[model samples]
Target: MNTTQELTLFDNESEVELFKHKITLEKIKNELINFGLTSNQSKVFIYLGKYGSKTASEIAKALQLPRTETYHLVNSLQNMGLVTAELSHPTKYTSLEMKKAIATLVKQEQQRIEYLAGKEESLSQMWNELPFFVVETDESKSEKMQLLHGLAAITNKIKEMVGSSTENIRVFGSMADVLRLYHSDVFDWIDNAPTELKMVISPMTKKPEFVSDLDQDKIRSLVSGSDKKCFVINDSKEILIFMRNANHPTRQTFAWWSDSETLVEMMSMLFDLSWEKGEMV
Candidate 1:
């Protein structure tokens, strides 16, 4: 840890947004790459920003970039006025002036947003002629919807019906719970848990390789680590399975989760028999 670490702790939106691009397997790492900074340059800056002030050696170790290459980047950030060297003892560089760096990023983003907004506005205006109903919700209904906005209510309802399910949750459809509903931290909790996970993927999902040869791995790991540690039962009992949008709670989109024992048990039985047959690929 060093100067970069110090600044990165304050890593506001833009820095965080960098990694958001390649989160899904749908996109590759290059898709997240920015032309403004070389991968090494970005790595060094990101490391220093996240790790705080650090010696060149620390930056190299933390970023796992080669020492000689790191020195090149250190020189580059300094030349670009993005990083400053400390005068005292062990000699470290920092990138604490996030205001400028982030502002530069924001300016570019603003220009892009402006362009997109202009296009969107034009499209909306053109589509104005399309017949659409303006269903004005009564104040009472709006207030009721607001009260039920919490997904905890949805999950809580499932829990109430099934009673604390010890079995792993079987999920179908795309990663609705994660992409649409919960934060990564909460998903991590679900993923790392001993709960079983069985997914009958929807056509909307791109099935990853090795799904049915020996050990099928999907609908997990995208959130948590360690594939083998999971209990993955097909046909879950007391688990909610639905085709809901992950962002529904926020977007006010409606979704449903079934708490039926019949569905859960059937899924569980299929999972057990498949496990014996090496259906997991």
Candidate 2:
């Protein structure tokens, strides 16, 4: 039998096998650390795993860790379902099957994910209310008229204007555009009504009673003599105008939005005139 000075074990087949097992344990310990286990916990788990059942004091001596710390680590691992203890006099701790132990940790992570998913909507509402987010359209920034094209951008702009409207919301639009707003839940703000909504629908379009919760008196609509889709919010603070493009074979939509007081006033006056001419629905 022969061995190199630096090599701890290598004289024969049995010693080489023992060294291989030690190497395997070290690899497993590193893997456990990567799985979010503390260094001490990974070392203790590896020791218990390799040696099968062992007393806490023995494990501490083998790992050169303090007895008290080793005991605490064992208890944590046990609570995490990675280790189990025998009820005998000097309790012996043994690592659970590696596959089952990892499965338990994965299950815990999944549960946390589901919990966060359930709270996302409420958390998003709270985040929106937080003061840290800057308001994009400040009244003082008069030149900040935002041009919005496409149905989605225009719909969102309308929702934002309606959501922040304080005194009144006057709408002039085709029945289809109004229906799109209703289905998208933009009319949800009407639940907090008393902020009067005077609407005018295109004479060629059919009217629909959109939201059931809003006070019908607060939402008065009439048939418009002319056809155009536009809305003004809070006495000319903001305005969104939709331009119909019936020429598009695909029937695509487009719109313009602005918070400029000048633009809003012009749009508001037009909406008022449309409302006056419209026959009450």
Candidates in order, TM-scores: namely: 0.28, 0.44
Instruction: Estimate, for each residue in 93-174, the C-alpha lDDT of model 1 and write its tens digit.
Output: 9984557875765676688879998899789988997997777667433311112234555544433432344565554433
Q: After superposition, which runs of candidate 1 have C-alpha atoms over 4 Å from their true positions?
A: 1-152, 155-163, 175-178, 181-186, 204-236, 241-249, 255-259, 266-281
Please tell me which predicted candidate would have the highest lDDT against the true structure.
2
**lDDT tens digits, residue span 186-211, model 2:** 66665455566766666534546553
Backbone clashes for every candidate come to: 34, 0
CA error at residue 242 for candidate 1, angstroms: 3.7
Looking at candidate 1, the ten consecutive residues that score lowest on lDDT are 225-234
lDDT of each: 0.50, 0.67
lDDT of 1 at 265: 72
All models, RMSD in angstroms: 17.7, 17.7
Give the TM-score (vs. native) of candidate 1: 0.28
